[model samples]
Target: MRYARFTGLISVLVANAIPGTALGQSVRIVPDLTTNSIVVFQGVDETAHFYYVPLEMDFVRAADGKPRLGVQYFKEGDGDSWRVAVSTSIKPAASDSELAALKAKLPKDNNVTLSPLVLDFASSYVRFSEAKKPTIFSLESGTLSAGSSIAMKFEFTGTHDAVLQALAASGPEVGVMAIITPDASLVQGEELVFSGAAVADLFEKEKFLLLNSFDESNAVVAFIINGNHSAEAAARSWLKSKLGSPEIGKDDKGVWRYGWDLTRPELLADLRSSPKISLPTFSNVEPPNKALLLPFGNICKDYPDNIVNLETGTAGCN
Candidate 1:
């Protein structure tokens, strides 16, 4: 793995268990459009579920194991089954003993063998498989270029088509961060402060200044997405009156920022208010909040001034 070689994947977590506990069995992570934290669940449903914690990134250990990310391995109320999200430093057990311990604690109902799964602890880019499908997790070696179109999950499809179509039809928004590679390719773009259909579209960091999604609350979009160069160009053409040709300049510090005095105020306002989008929730997973699907994360591991909250767990089989 690279220094910060991290990626995303929907995975199974590990924890201990007790007999006769009817707490939960499966994990359900709902990126609440209403806030920055995710509503974590296990058990048959949400009501019996417990622990709504922060979905951290990269480090398996999040600053004293501050509830990193992972799906619960055993049912709810089971000993430590929900405490998962591997740390880089804490090595996993030598296999057999760990899995055996897990299998023993789980209910006779659909007991499973624990599998080591990779994760993009930062971005929630995952498609869970009901049939226990195997997955491959890889990382991009370099950052994308400026002006290059970046797509989320180049291997996945239909990330946020409807919203991308809207953005493609509408001009770009302010306070939004569009990712670009060194070569000026529009690798990806994001509306850091917006939600709903708008968030369904943004997938990368902002090259320009960032806008707060909310006061002290960074409730970002729930899904990863890519910019459609063709669609964006076509949309800009359609909304010429609202869009303007502005100068892209850098400050003394060499940070890239867009000069937007000529941009449409209405468009800017719309983009500014588009944060906090609700993703479609799964009734089968957790029924209480059907309108609770969205993405929440930051591209911090590789960031220069960033801090890493490393964590580790010592789980053993009974």
Candidate 2:
């Protein structure tokens, strides 16, 4: 029973991380509500560099129902693989002594050390928000630079795999962030390329539109439906009428899922008009457990078993 309760919390928290609302094109500044404080973007040219700074505390409830402050960064233009995120926990520190203690506990190996601006950025950025924008800033390389925030540059000593392993082992005692960079030699040649935000945009629509997998060749788009059996049945039947037969399943938390094949032209036609699922506003949504990480690091997995979250000592599987 305790296991079941933990799993239920995991499901809700995981769902909460999903961006509650769509972002507008005009520099949608959001607090990085997770651990990653400074996001560093490496450019195609060795000299090109840019960053996004979150200027305030974006607090969200973890699975344990405790509030965690986080920040997020965004960059426009084509995608680049040399993106690194650095984050730490400072809000929980009640005093200067406590903050120093926490900083002392940070990892120094693998070139992972606390930034001098870590505390200042944490304390000062928390003061700025969507309502109260930062007065001083500049746009560089398609990213918003909060000029006042401390600049951070991290150097990892090993390969991407080794760095990732080191990061996973850092634990909650020290805040750790992940960098998405390729290990291959070709990475140097990797230039920014356009990725359709169609999927991301569709997520905002909350409609029964096609949710393609990372490999866009797949024919099915799977979506989560929040409702009881009757509601699920109604949705399923309605979908069947429009798009024909679909694979239906329920998650461990009893959320309904509908998977439709896009290979069929007729289904594709109907899918464009499939009804949108009305979701609760973002303000009402709760954040997922920070301890519990997303399965395969993908936020939009289908089954709960694919989702994993870390408990105190043991790892909880979806």
Candidate maximizing TM-score: 1
Residue pairs in collision within model 2: 13-288, 32-70, 32-71, 32-72, 33-70, 55-125, 207-276, 292-309, 304-318, 305-318
Off-target runs (Cα >4 Å) in candidate 2 are 1-145, 150-318
How well is each residue in 115-166 modelled by candidate 1, as lDDT tens digits? 3221111112322232434233332323221112212221221213322221
Best by lDDT: 1
Cα lDDT over the full model 1: 0.26
Whole-model Cα lDDT per candidate? Answer: 0.26, 0.26
144: Cα error in model 1, Å? 29
Write model 2 residue lDDT over 1-318, tens digit each, in one string. 000011111011111112231211111111231125322222122111111222122223358643332221222245321222323222211233533554454444453322211111212111122244322222111111122222222222333333233234321111222211111111111111111233234433543333223112221122222222223333334444545555665544896776543345444444445333332111112322111111112111212222222212222221
User: What value of lDDT does candidate 2 attain over all alpha carbons?
Assistant: 0.26
